[model samples]
Target: MNIIDKTDEELLAIGTPWWEDLIKYSNKGQYGKFIQNFSTDLLRGLNEVEVGNQFAKSDLTRSLDTNYDFLGFIRRGEHVSFLFRVRSTKKPGEWLGRMVLGYERGEVKIFAASIF
Candidate 1:
């Protein structure tokens, strides 16, 4: 289903703290979710790799970016763990550390993130 048509229950099931209503209206495209949640550098890296897949009409890249091998998720109370890596294509093998997103009270806030 399209973003506008998705039910609140379905959005809540995804387990992010940002309320469905807040997310749905904040950006025209849900693709911006990544940009909204991540840092400028990270977003840039993602853009370079086409992580949001703006060129393609699909959620495949966004989903993968959020839940990848190195990047995983875990639900702990009000917080949903987010884990992911960032590496520059130009740098090749040079990779960055994992990051996490803390969710609480309908807000998907970054609790503690670092370059691991």
Candidate 2:
């Protein structure tokens, strides 16, 4: 399961361990880093809040409970993006996600998620 590419199969393969780690990592108070690496500034709301480590497992589970599926990727400039949609859900249908990445030296950070 590749975190950078974020394919459907990879998201599905994430399993429990990866999700647990992700929750811990984000809740540890690095949400800005997570946002900067996961979603791009091009979409909207790039930086308006502080990382307060407010992510909860219930919220994550609720978000993941949707039937939305990772369809594939679309390339735009330095970003490679993916789309997830849910038709049967009560919420809106159009939500977009992109992978934002930055590199310094050899340190790698992950900022990938479905921003809906």
Candidate 3:
């Protein structure tokens, strides 16, 4: 089935693993693994240098808590945006992590992702 056709619960199940990989690779500063499931357009816009710099400079990216809370999701056209409540292992307070998923080349891929 097409990814966008899935219900919120189904979509969350589908997206959780990908989101976990994002957090895992981000904490380890593994750019390749981090971008492995990114959409073509998203991959094209990223570079190892910038991503590495961000990983090095941001405490949040390097210290993400894996035990995150799945807040909910939003469906827009061909995309499903999942929201996560994330915390830093090395800091206080929480942050919002958003991962937007869509189909690319017949597979689910992350079209956009951010933490704030």
Best by TM-score: 3
Q: What is the per-residue lDDT of model 3 for residues 1-116, given as tens digits with 9 covering 90 to 100?
A: 46668987778788999999999999998988898888999988988688899988998899999999999878779898899999999999999999999888888889999999
lDDT of 2 by residue, 1-116 (tens): 23355554544443223333433454454454434433333326443342242343324323432344556555444434445443322343455433333222333233354354
Cα RMSDs, all models: 11.8, 7.5, 1.3
Against the reference, the lDDT scores of all candidates come to: 0.39, 0.40, 0.90
Alpha carbon lDDT at 10, candidate 3: 78
Candidate rank order under lDDT: 3, 2, 1
Residue range 1-116, candidate 1, lDDT tens digits = 12223344543454344332222422234454534555344444554445334425433221222212344555555444444454332233423333444433444444433333
Summed backbone clashes in each candidate are 2, 3, 0
Q: Candidates' TM-scores?
A: 0.31, 0.35, 0.93
Looking at model 1, the pairs that clash are 71-83, 97-116
What's the lDDT for residue 115 in model 3? 96
